[model samples]
Target: MSIEHLRARASICALTLISSLTLASGCSDDGGAEESESTDESGESESTDESESTDESESTDETESTDETDTTDGTEETDTGNLSCEPEGDVTISYSIEVGALDEPPSVDLDLACTLAEIDTDGVTQVLILDCPELENVAVIDIAVSPDMSLPLVGGEAISMRYILEGPWWFNTYLRLDVEGTGHLLTLIDGDSLLPPEEFEFTSPVELTAVYDLCEPVSDGCGQRERLALMTTIAGEEAQIFDANYAEVGGEEGTEIWVGAAGHLHEIECTDTPDEWFQVLIVGPGEG
Candidate 1:
């Protein structure tokens, strides 16, 4: 009886061991599948994140590029582009300029609103990057007339008005004028901002009735010596001032003739100034 019991117990134990091994193997396989699935999910998530990051990066790059392009376009418009260089009708440029006077008050301001008489393309136009906005449409008026003053113009008059551009950044400014020969400096600026002033004697208006008044014909009121001096002053050229023809106030000479008038080429007289004197109404160089 003891041998039989022992044999049966050994067989049962062996069967239990086999069953445990089988269950353990099945659990291992199931765990491996779960682990693989988890790894695959993690990989997918990383890939999605990378894709999103790449898209975002591309979007940011495009935005930056667009901004750069816009900035470039805007800068280009500022340099050479003008809202209106040529106004519709007669453009009356009202500006003030101040220059350093050679005399006292190194700062001499000239506030003048001159009518753009005509476009005199005798001077050169410079392509400068001004710090002022008003300079965007800068049409220089080179021919300026002298207003009918006590001491009027005998020959002609053309004081070049300069453009003064000055500000904090690259877009601010004013204007100025050192009245030729007068030495008295004047500017057409409103503020006290430091500016880089530039002058253009290039163009004038078509029909500008500038303040400059015509000179009087040589006469006793103007005086003989005075007329010669006037011609020399306005002609600008010392050589040519009294080089033109001359006439007496009266048809006849020795009528207490003080000086000479720019009468004509043929019908005229020579003067003591050596150079003949032909008087023009306008000063400087005027078309009329």
Candidate 2:
């Protein structure tokens, strides 16, 4: 072969080698690009997952902190005690009356009134009123007696009496009796007296009860009606009258009594027959 022909063949071979090398370099670059893109995608997915995880953790922490703050704040959890029923301030007996027949047997009636210096939220009271009257010229008969000395009263041989208390709450009523006079008395009827002596905590009616002579009187029966007209203090503060009628009584036939937050007053009319007996009741409060 000629030298020029050999030179041309060598040139062609060189060109072919250069072309193959270039194609290989391009294929390698494409493979590297695909690998880089896959790595980028994986890194992005990992970043997104990490961000979501961090956000969830932060949210949980914030929720826990809020719960702690709420617990630390001052707030009542439960109620502790029961309500009380004792009187909050000073109390007074405002009025009283004596209930019963006059002739056959000297009957008795009692009425009482009270006042409060201040009202309380609970409205509970522990005060109890009692009746203890003096029998100066009083007489007792076995049967019911009328205002007139002539005939016995209507009911059977019973000394019927009743006591009532007026208040916003109707609590059970109770009575204590002390006889400075000359007789022993027994309670005839026993009502619901075993209740708290105080009024209800809310705005309600007060309780009241009247217990008649459960046992016989200390003395058999007196023949005269009790004449009680004296002054006594009640609840250690209020002033009260036993038998004497106040000016408000006026000239009424039956025993007219008025009781209010201020005090109690009695009214008795003078009868033509001096032999008639007068019945009166005095009420007060003490530790019981």
Candidate 3:
């Protein structure tokens, strides 16, 4: 009876042990599968983040490249159009003496001819009177002239001349040949001058610059009052010649005058030099 009982008990215990071992192994397999799934999900999230960062970097680089192209185009626009001054209208000159002198070829342009007046007025004084309605100045240009003329007033080839602005207003100025020899139209500047007149030399070439300053008037011996005027130098050197005076008192602007020899003149409108220079032209007559 004791041997049979011991054998049965041992067999039942062995079966129970086998079932417990099987259950523990199944639980371990489930935990390992969950850990593998968690690792795969973390790797996928990191890949997505890397892709988005690369896309943002490319977009930023493209935006920076576009701004560099626009800055280069703005520099080329300022070179060619420096001075745009031109004659506003028909600029003419007249004299107080006889109309017999043949002003045939002396004119504003190189090829254009002058107006020849054939009137035989019997006047004792032979003065070159400048009457420009546009310029608004009734100034005398020349004190004496031959009833007969002998030279052609040419531009870019006239005689050089300089003048000192005498009297308060540009009422009077002294003139002479700019070069050593005479008998030529001394101060005919044909074109507009360059800007920023500082450090400029008034040489043989017809170039004028400007400076902003004050002007005052003067009274002559005959009790005549001259207006405040503009003064310029020859090649930015010696001898400041009086060019123009304020047309009216307390006026902010004035008419520009180009003083050429034999009283050849041209007047243009100019604004008040409020701060920077507003293109003031200082020219004189040279040998023609």
Of the candidates shown, which would achieve the greatest lDDT relative to the real structure?
3
- What's the lDDT for all of these models? 0.18, 0.17, 0.18
Whole-model lDDT for model 1 versus the true structure? 0.18
- Which residue runs of candidate 3 sit more than 4 Å off their true CA positions? 1-183, 187-207, 216-236, 243-288
Query: Which has the higher TM-score value, candidate number 2 or candidate number 3?
Result: 3
Q: Where's the lowest-lDDT run of ten residues in candidate 3?
A: 17-26
Query: Rank by TM-score, descending?
Result: 3, 1, 2
Tens-digit lDDT string for candidate 2 (173-230) = 2232222231112111101112212331111111122112221212101112222222
Query: Residue 272's C-alpha lDDT in candidate 3?
Result: 9
Model 2 poorest 10 in a row by lDDT: 17-26
What lDDT tens digits, residue by residue, belong to model 1 across residues 1-288? 232342333233121100000000011111111110001001000101001000000010111111111111101111222222221121111111212211212122223333222222212311111111222222222221112111222222233444322111111122332234542222221111112233312121111110111222233211222111211211121212121222122122111111112111111121111111111222122211
lDDT of 3 by residue, 195-246 (tens): 2122322333232223222222122211212121123333223222222211
Ranked candidates, highest lDDT first = 3, 1, 2
In model 1, the worst 10-residue window by lDDT is 17-26
